[model samples]
Target: MRITPDTLEIGSTQKRNKNETLETFLKRITHVSLVGKAIVLMENLNFCKNLNVLYLYDNKITYITGLECCRNLTRLYLQNNAIEEITGLDVGLDRLNVLHLHNNRIRRITGLHLLPSLEHLKLDNQRLDPGEQLEFDGECLLALASSLRYLTLTNNHIKDISPLEKLKSLESLDLAVNSIQDVEPLESLLSACSYLSNVNVLGNPVANAGPPVKLRQRLILASPTLTCLNEKDIPQVERMFVENMRHAQRSRRSAKDHNHTRDQTTSLGVSGTAGVATPACQEEKPFPHLPPFASQYRDLMLSQLTKNTATERRLSDSNLHISPRKVASAAEALHRD
Candidate 1:
C-alpha cells in the first residue's frame, strides 16, 4: 500500500525519534472507535496528560481500572461496552463532568461515588433490575449530592429512593421506568432540591406510587417556585378525601367510647329491663286451675297475683340460691294444705 504525499491525510505529525510515545499518537487522535478487542494500547499515555476528551465506545473492555493515569480527562464516553463494574476512576479527574455508561452490565453503583465534579450521568438501558437494585446508603447520593444536576436512571431496578433526598442540587431526575412504589421516599428530596422542576415517572404503575399527588404535581403544589412542564398532568384536589379522613377518625373514637361504656355496664350488672332479678323465698301455693268458662275471669284475677309474686321475688336478695325443685315441692304442699 503505497501512498503519495498528496494522497496522505493532513495533520500526520510524527516524531523524528525512533521510539515515539503512544501518548503522542493518542493525543493526535481526538476520537477513536476502538474495534473488537484489538487491545487499544496506550500502556503509558503519560504524554497525553493534556488530552481533554476520550471516546472508547463499543469496545470489549471488561474493566475501567487502568484509567487512573488519565488525570486531565474531562469527557469520557464508554457506552455499549462489556464492562461489568466501574472501579478505577480517580477522584483526580475533577474536571470530568460527563460520563456515558449506558448499555453496560454494571450491577452496583459503588465506585462512582467519588465523582463530585460530575454533572451529567447516563446509566440507561443497563442490566439493573428490581432485585439487583443499587443496594446503597446515603453515601452514594451524598457523593453526587451537590455536583449532579442532571441524571438518567431509566430502565433500572431502583425501588426505594430515600437516598436521593441528599441530591439537593439535582434539576432533572429521569426515573421513568424504575420499580419505585412509594413517592414519600422522594418527598423530602423533592422538597429539598429547589432546583428540581422536572420529574419523569410516567412508565411506572400509578399504584406503586406514593401519596395522592404524583412526583411532578407534588413538587409543584408544595414548592412555590417549582412548576411542572405540563400543568394539566397535575391531579385534581378532592375535598371529599379530607372530609372522609376526618369522619373516619371521629367514628373510630365514637366506637371506642361505645364499647367502653358497654363493657362498664356489663361489668356493673346494671343492664336494665332485661336483667333476671331473683326474689326472696315464699311459702305460696301454686294457684289452682280455673274452669274453662271462667278462664278469662281467672286470668284477669291471676294477673294481679302474678305481679305480687314478681314484686316479692324482686324484694328477696338470696332467692337465686334456692333450688327450683324445693320451691315447687313447697308450693304443692302449701296447695295441699
Candidate 2:
C-alpha cells in the first residue's frame, strides 16, 4: 500500500459519511493505523492537518515523509519498520510529544532539533551494518536538552553516552542490553541531569558481574534521585543511605580538589622561584596564576597580586616564600608620595 488518496481510507480510524467530501474526511482523521501494510512509500494524505496519532509500524516504510502536514500529531509509531533515516518529523511538528522509531535500520539519529515539545523518544534496536555504532547529532541533542524527559536507546551498541549530558530533563533512561562497559559517562550525566529516576543498563558488559551489593552501592552513589535501577526498585532506606554517602563523598572531593590546587600552586611557586618553570603557561605575563581556575576566584587573585606587587615591589607572592604578608603593605607609603 503506497498511501495514495484512494487507498488512505483503508487504515483510517475516521469514517467518511455518505455525502462527506474528501477535505472534510481528511480533516476528521485523527488516527490512522496502517500497520503490516508493506507501505514502501509514504505519500499523499498531506491534508491530514488535524491528525493527532498515526500508527505505521510493522511495515516496509523505507523513509519518513509526508508527515509535514500533521502539525497536530503528538504520538507517532514507526517502529519495526525499514526506516533507514530520521526525517519528515522535523518541520511544523511543534506539538509532537512522543515518537517511536525503534527496530529500524537508522544508523545516525538526527533531524529532530525542530521538535521542541518532544518528550518521549525510542530508538531501540537500530538495525545497522556490521561494525556500526549508533551516532547522534549535536544540534539535535542541544534542542532536546530541556524538552526530552523519557529516552530509550536500548540494544543500539552505544558506548560513549557523553553526548547526552546536555539532556538535563531526562527522567527515565533505558539503555539495556547494549555494549556500554563504562559507567563514568553515565555518572557524569547524572551529575548534570539530576532528574533521572529509572535507569536500565542490564545485559551490558558493565560491572554487573561484581557483587550485587557492590553494584547497587555504586549505582546509588552515582545518582541519588534514582528510584529504580535495571528495573529493580530501590528501597527508601537504601536511597537515604546513598544520599548520605554521596554528600560525604562530595565533601571529601571538595577538600581534595582544594588541597590539590594548593599543592599545585606551591609547586608552581617553587618552580618559578628556581627559574625553571611555572604553571602551564597560556601567556607570558606577570601573573603566575594557573590558567585553569574558577572564574569567581579571579577577582580575589587580581587584588592579591596587585597588592603584593604595589606594596612589596614584587610582581608575585606565594606560599613558596616565608612572611609573605609581613613584607610590606600598600598603606605603608600612604603618608608619602
Candidate 3:
C-alpha cells in the first residue's frame, strides 16, 4: 500500500484537530514517522509538499521510490530494511543533510553526488554475499569532499577506505568490524582530513596488529585532532605526550639545521689575520606553510605547558592497556599553577 495522506496524518506526531479531516491535516504536516508498519511500497509521499524529515525505517521496504518531490527533505532514516539498491534519492534531495541507509542490502553506492549539502552519511552493515565488500561510486566521493563530515561504513567487508581521503571535512569516522588489514590509508587521512577527531576501527586487523598504545600515539600525533581511537577516549596526558614529542623533534631539527648552517658558514670563511677570520651568510625574511590543523589544534596545544617525556615513559609501560591517568600523573607536577 502507498504511504497515503491518511497514513501520513496518522503517522505524524502533529496532532490533528477533531474537526480536521485527513485531507486537511496532510497539507500542513511537515514530517512523517512510519516505522515498522509492514510497509511494502514507497509510494504517494509527494502530497506532503512541505515535508522536511522522513522516518520510514524498520519495515519491509524493498526499493527506495516515491520521494521525488521532497526538495526540502534534510534527513531520511531508512535503515534496517530489505532495500537492495540506492535509488530515488538524487531527484530532489539537494538540501538533504543526513541519510541513514545502513543495515540493508545495498551493494553499491551511487547517486550521492547530487546531495551537495549532505554532511552525515551512514551506509554501514550492508547485507552482502560472503566475502563481498560494499562498493562505492567515485564521483560521489569527490562531491562529498567539502561538506560531508561524520561517516560510518562498518561491517561491509571493506578492506580499504582510501576513497575517504577526499572527504576533507570529515570529523568522525567509524570503520569498525571490517576486513581492513592496512592502516596506511587511515594514516594518510590524518593529513588529508585534518578535522578528523574520532575514529573507530576496533575490530579491524590493523588495530590488533601492532602495539595499541603506540598505534594510538602515532595516529594522535599525525592528526593532532584525534582524541578517540577504537572507542577509547584520549585524555590530556596523551595529547601532552605528543606535544612533547613534537617539541623534541622540532628541537632536534633546529639544532641539526643550525649545525649544518654553521658548517656551511665555516666552509665559506675568509682569512683576515693569523687568528681572525670572517664568515659570510645571507639573511632574508621567513615563510612557512602550515597545515590546516594548526589553528584547529589550539585547544589541544597549550602554550604554558612545558615539554616532557614522562608520559611517553608511562605509555611504554603497557603496549595494550594504556592508563591515561597514570600517564598524566607522571607529568602532573609540571601542570600545577
TM-score of each: 0.56, 0.71, 0.72
- The 10 consecutive residues of candidate 1 with the worst lDDT sum are 2-11
Best-to-worst order by lDDT is 2, 3, 1
Candidate 1 has what TM-score?
0.56
Clashes of each: 4, 0, 0
Question: What does candidate 3's lDDT look like per residue over 1-337, in tens digits?
Answer: 5577778888888988899877777767788999988898988787776788899999889988888877888899999999988887779688899999999999887878788999999999999999789887778789888999989999998886777788889999999998888767778878889999899988888889998887777778778788787898889897998889979999999999999986654443422122434243322223233334432333243321213433432333122222334434434434442
- Residue range 36-86, candidate 1, lDDT tens digits: 333333233333455566666666666774456567677787777777777
lDDT of each: 0.60, 0.79, 0.78
Show where candidate 1 strays beyond 4 Å.
Answer: 1-47, 207-216, 229-337
By TM-score, the better pick of 1 and 2 is 2
Q: State each model's C-alpha RMSD to the native.
A: 12.0, 14.9, 22.6
RMSD of 2: 14.9
lDDT of 3: 0.78
**Which predicted model would earn the best lDDT?**
2
